[model samples]
Target: MEVDEEENNDSISEEEEDSDREPNPKHCFITNLPDQLLLLILSFLPILDAINTSFLSTRWRYLWTLTTNLDFDQRLIVSPTEDFSKSRRLFASFVDRALLLHEGSEINRLRIWFNYDHELYESHLSSWIRFAILRNVKELDLQLEREWEDNDFYFWDMPFLFNPSVFIRDSVRVLKLCLPGLDPTPDMRFGSITTLHLKQIGLTERTIPDLLNFCPHLENLVLDHVGLYMAPLKIYSVKLKTLSIVNSIQMNGSVEIDAPNLLSFTCIRYLADDYLIKDVSSLVEAVIIFSLSNAFFQNWRKIVNALTHVRSLKVQSWWWMQHLQQTGEYSEEILPHKFRYLELETVLSKMELPGIARILRISPNLETMVLESDMVDQMVYMADNNASEESYTGDYLEKVFTGSPLYLKKLKITSFLATDNEIELVKYLLKYGVALEKIILVPYKTGLVSVSPEHLAERFQELQAFPRSSKDAEILLL
Candidate 1:
């Protein structure tokens, strides 16, 4: 009996030992991943978020140190109640610490946005830039906004801590500078930079040449709200494909572009003596906007003549009718002849129809056209008053509708009031435009006034069904 009891006790002890063993974890907990995979994951995160991930675990504590792209945004750090001075100090310290932590890494890009407290942060900015150069950063974007209180004064004259020449190097491929009305005299040896953007900068004749000379390999150039103090600077870029200049008022100088590979060009509020874009056979699209002035007529002619080969064109001449009326020669001489698509936004009048006709004459193959009238109420009222005078009404409508090139298949008219005269205009389109396939009329619906979609669709059908030669035409309403 004693031997049997001992055997049972031994069996129970073995079972208990087996039950105490724990199951092995299916996946191993790896504290470190391949550096390439870490970078791939970090690339998907915003710079700030990536930096904050350092606190997640000890493994991630210095993961940001391996990141080559650093972006510091003061707007994200500054609170409305925070002291600006303290915020600037903290920003400087954080940048310093991040750079020190990532000392050995190859920094590829650094983007910073901060309020331009020149007196306080100028030296710190210089240090940060030096650090970026030491680490061989390829892309650098610095956007500086001055406080509202400094608006009335000249903030551009603030003493710069670093010479602009020091920042120009072969390692940098993209550089963007947003300064407070300062003309930067960058070194010409920074030919490695492929993209350049300058905002609210003053580019004098000498300064413009200096910049072009420096960025010889630049592929994309953007100048926004920049002033040209001298005659338009001559620009010659063999590698440049995209160029955009916006809200630039100083026009005494003309921009002479000789980029052979240029693909796209956009210019707004650029008043220059001779606007020239030559040998850009690769040009595919262009947008030229001019403020209504007599000087613009010359520039417009120059631009239209250069961009005649463009397939798509957008011409926005705000208040141009008033200027044309005042000048007495209400005709646009330089109109594109080969544009497949055209979008015009301006007030239309009888005097301007000839210009429109001229455009259609040149672009005989135009497939689509959009006409947007600025003053719908006035146009409708005028059409109503002259409804009885068929000659007056017919002539006006003929000038507006037939002026379009004969091949226009799609016509979109927006902001039209359904007054009798406007309706007559629509009728003239239905009667005259032989190749018109689709006509979309969108009535001006604002405030408490509204047009029923059903009513509009019905009226459109009635207009299309009005006794016509062909049954292929369709009218749409919105």
Candidate 2:
């Protein structure tokens, strides 16, 4: 009887243990996915992260090498406190190993970004370029930031020179380079390239014109922080549709553009340089941003007159308002062109009201208006002029828009602080904008101030109290 009881107790314990154990899960469905789909998933990840997926299982060990899009950024490998020389060596070694192990015959895109020292890594850089060209890369981006910024450039001594014949394969369609200098060879012709972005490169007067001849199919060109050899840089591309020049240096003389097929033009420069958009009859959009200077006001007028055909215009020039106040020359000349959209980035103060009024009068067909306040310059003019808190005199717009039709249907104000002056301006617009349908108010986003719930509620109530001239008008706070 005792032996029977011991056996039954042991059997009960075994049953309990069995019931507590969970069943094995089914095989992972993702592991069974097709190789092409897996490669596509890996392509979206950073190159380092993609490589890390190799450690997951034996099936993924070499799969990363088959990815067609590879971006090797040195910032991924080196920590901020790492030794510079050691980090460079580590980065270079990894790139070489990765490229050697890559199995793709044709790369869809390849980007390499690093702080380049010509004396130490010129050979490595040259080999990388050759490797991309040999692999039939469709889009290649090389952003080799030079270590030395003060050194003078010599054309023949340009770093990372490759065989001019290697690039004639007509495979690369988009090429972006941010090198100290570019090697211009007579035989260099990119027949398949459609878009080219060159940044921080030194170009001479003859370099660009000569380079354009090489890229027969190029349609988009961007020059950023590019220092020119002399003044009067002439760009005459027949097939080019978009052109942008930002933060360019040494272009003191006029930049004459004659791209007949151009559709969009953007110029953001600090210097008070002049530009002539000749033969660009197809231009429909223009963005011009310049710093305040005595010579910029005249250039602003010329650029606006030249862009008469543009239906959309966005300009940021605080000097225009300041200059107008000092001179008090309110010309009543209406532009021959009519703009459908106008965006102004300036300080919305008492002194700038007339300037804003002038723009509204000129744009008779304007349907949309966007006012973006430059917060940095917002207080400069106000304090300098010793302006009062109530800047809007209620009749400023009416006086300026007299006889000029107010066709504005939509309005947007960004960097709104909901101050007394700003509230007055909103009130004035609401009272006068008879055809207004909606108004958007976007609070300033400097990341320094946070609005309390109470403050937000108060602001909402205040906006609701303002009477609107248009019964259909809606006020939205964003």
Best by TM-score: 2
lDDT by residue (176-284, candidate 2, tens digit) is 8887756667877898999989887777768778778999988999988787744568899999999988987655566788999999988887343666768878998
Error of 1 at 142 (Å): 1.0
TM-score of each: 0.71, 0.85
Clashing residue pairs in candidate 2 are: none
Predicted candidate 1 versus true structure: per-residue lDDT over 70-179, tens digit per residue: 88787664454567776666666666665665644567888888876766777878888888888888998888866646554334344554457667668999988887
Whole-model alpha-carbon lDDT for candidate 2: 0.72
CA-lDDT, candidates in order: 0.66, 0.72
Off by over 4 Å in 2: 1-29, 148-166, 270-273, 317-319, 326-337, 377-398, 401-405, 448-453
Error of 2 at 193 (Å): 0.9
Cα RMSD (Å) per model?
12.9, 10.8
